[model samples]
Target: MFDLNTLVRPNILTLEPYRCARDDFKVGILLDANENTHGPALSEISETEKFLELNRYPDPHQHELKQQIINFRNSKPNQYSEQPLEIENLCLGVGSDESIDMLLRCCCKPGEDKLLICPPTYGMYNICATINDVEIVRIPLTVPDFQIDSNAILNKITEDPNIKLLYLTSPGNPTAKLINVESIIDLLKRSSSKWNGLIVVDEAYIDFTLPNGSYSQSMSTLVNQFPNLVVLQTLSKSFGLAGIRLGITYTNKKLSKLLNSMKYPYNISSLTSNVALKATTKEGISIMQDYVKKIIEQREIVLNKILDLKYVGKNLGGKDANFILVEILDKFGKPSNEIASKLYNTLAVDNSVVVRFRGNELNCFGGLRISIGTEEENKTLLYKFERVLNELNA
Candidate 1:
């Protein structure tokens, strides 16, 4: 049996969550929590409808928001679950970063336990491990395709009983490739017998997985089936809600409760919750889907046009996410970090057409990760990118 308590830290299991004033009551005179009853000090003449309740604390539990998210996920065309998502199966966070940090804290025992990560994935997994004083066991994804090395990961997990958490990124950062679902399922199966660790699948770009902006391959559907599985998602990418900093964690009900217990009371602000609530509604989701359609169209346009550049080599990574990773070629027709770095700097400093330089990452030599932007923005990027490559390639 996969025991959640065995995997979690003893202290975290016993830790009492902080209770806020909003927990018990939300109506009548709320003097329990000190606040400016007069409301936010803003211009009375200003449009303050959205920012109306600045004086009152946000709902710590966020019942309505969580229900909306569950409905959204369950309504997806490909989202399958034996027991459909419930409010208890969801936990809200500032961003996926908070959930990552919380999981590290809950499972890893400082310097003793280990957190496994696949290289060229999301950097936050490694950063959060460091912050929580947990050691990282790096298992680099197989080269060229950037797919998971299932055998290698299983071997490592079996060898190290101390590996408390395994972080996998779908449509990964820089790589922009989805780790195979079968591989993930295999890892989860092994955790039952060989190891007892939580498997975190970060799906920040999952909304862009299908052409229709649906997370057809999302690991979220498996959360109800597997207690050890935790799927992380956010509104930052496809939803265009980065400023709000809303992240959703989908897992089993018990694990979700544990995560809720560990989080600070009133973590989700009133403003954020309001915006997120609106965004997850049926109409809001339709708007987000339309945006995804536009982005995918732009992504393809950029991919085809970018390859035409003289210095640009073969495209790297699957174009599952809203970005494209292409190599910079040298005079010898080999991937060149020197040319890539120079082009990255020249574009940002001179042309202001900024993209990421991911040459430093494993197997991503001379790589430039370009995010798909608006139609006009992409045109500008292509124009500037070709101009810079011409100057640098020579």
Candidate 2:
């Protein structure tokens, strides 16, 4: 029912990937691809930069980094496979953005195929679909709880033969709610007939979930089990490596190879690859887990403190991610966008304690999405928010 060849675009399947010089040779005089050989032209460089061989082209295939990622994700409690994930199972990107775009390009024929999304989800899914000339069919999540309407979505999938991708976010952005695993399994099992495309699960904030780093809630391990499943992740969140701009895609070997074929020749830079290598190591993961613990502790403190304020209404979403979404109330105690806007501006411009105002999003009236910061930073945000809310309400 789920055929890989039929799902992918005819153009992409026949694409001849641009071959990089490094794919063939790595040693000897290295005269193949034009290079300075004299090293970087900077007047001065860091001691670490000196050894990176800045003049040479980075590896076209990052074998070492990919292996590290496989080992890290396959740690106990997560059974990715009996054989475990191999290099062919992964595809690295400049960010998850690249892979997201590539999936649209590789599957959807411009102005023909469609993408299905649940509302109050990530904006990029819509943005990317638009850029690729693909239509978007939005089915808003059920009100109050913000969970997926699995039955409704399945009905649509069964009827629409043109829907090529279904994007689901776990620990969803703005909402922070994780979709029920059984619900997802149902979608995967039932949507095989008419909707013959991939079901992409974006788990950017999954590591921030409770019992940090256990990864029991992640759908990445299911990649091996389902040919049509794709899971996207990044080093930006839990690993504290946003500066390197690395993202990962996990899928069946055929899809992974297709993505690799369609991507830029050297998408991952040397600097990014090196930093990510260290961060994916056992010691690096331990350090990251410790930081996640602190963030969760602070998240609770912020949630309890904000709810006590008169102008702050009840929470709008789950507390699964690093951020919390709470409503800002008016003088009459109803959700108010005017008050939320003023507070958002005053906190960032005057108090230097910034948080996002997401009142405009569906079912998120007068809402503010606040990310958990360090202890001192969280304290400053709560103090400023309370002081400002009172001044405006007074």
Candidate 3:
């Protein structure tokens, strides 16, 4: 029996979360929350249509928004024959960051419980764990390829039952490698015991993994089979709605209910939901698909251009995401962190073209992460990168 209550912290299990004023009543003067009855002070902004409800609190439920999300994700071709998900299977967060923090808060008992993570992956998992006072057990991914060591992870879980969550970032950050679907399933099957806890696969960049914009490879459909699995995705990357600050987590209804209960009543504002609703529509999805196609094309172009340069070493990882990771080689034909740092600084400060320097990450020594941009932007980045390389090599 995989009991979610057993995995969660004792305090969180019984604690009543803070109820926002909107919970009591949303209409009739709305004096519960104690807002300015006269409305916001900004006269210039009050005239705008969006600010008309400045005095009233946003809807805490966001039922309509979740339905739109369900429509968008379920519209994709599903690999498994499981029943379609309802709004109950989804939880909205400020971003993937909020979801991460909440998971730690609800499960891991600070100073007692711990979480597992594979490095050369997302940094927020570690950061959030630290902030929540939870210990992080680092199991670095295999070098060069940056794949998770599943066997080691299993051993770690067996050895330490205190590990409440395991974070796996697919199409990994800095590395941009996709952990194989089969490998993920294998982990899920092996970790079904009472000792092992939840597995969180952050698919923030999963939309860019395939050129056809098909999410058939996503593990979202397997949530029913493995109730312990949680898939986190965002509209920030592929939908091009980072400014809206919305993210979705697909999991079993039980866990989703727990997350919803613990999360802020009005976690997602009306404005963000309105914008996200439009972005998830049929026409909006079509626009996003078109954008993804162009970005994939640009990624290939940028990859080819970078590989053609003499100073660029072997490209790292599987290149499943919209970004590419490559090593910067020194004059002696060796990966050099010194050269990579210099090139990164020069491109950003002098050429006004910015890319992340991931030389400090494990197996990412002398690595630079370059995101695919518009054609003209890519050209500018390529030109600046080449000029910087030449100057350094000279």
lDDT of 3 by residue, 1-394 (tens): 3579788777777777677767765667567777778766665663444453765667777888889877766777346527777889889999898999998998888899999999978889888998999999989998767888989998998888898899999989978998888788888888886455899999999888772345466777677678889999898999999999998888889888888888998788767887888898889989998998999999999998899999998897667888999989999999999999999999989889999999999889899999899999999999889989989999
Candidate 1 C-alpha error for residue 126, in Å: 1.5
The global Cα lDDT (0 to 1) of model 1 is 0.86
Top-down TM-score ranking: 2, 1, 3
List the candidates' TM-scores in order. Answer: 0.96, 0.96, 0.94
lDDT of 1 by residue, 11-111 (tens): 87787878866677778988889888877776763455435477777788999988888887777633444667788988999999999999988888888
Global lDDT of model 2: 0.87
1-394, model 2: which lDDT tens digit per residue?
Answer: 7898999998888888788566777778888778898999999999878777888888878999999888877774242334457789899999888888989998999989999999898999989999999999988988888888988998887788899899988888889888877788778877776568889999999888763354467777678787888999999999988889999999989889889899888889899998998998899999998999999999999999999999999989988999999999988998999999999999999999889999998889899999999999998999999999989888
**Judged by lDDT, which candidate is best?**
2
Give me the displacement of residue 376 in model 2, in angstroms: 0.2
**By summed lDDT, which 10 consecutive residues of candidate 1 come out lowest?**
43-52
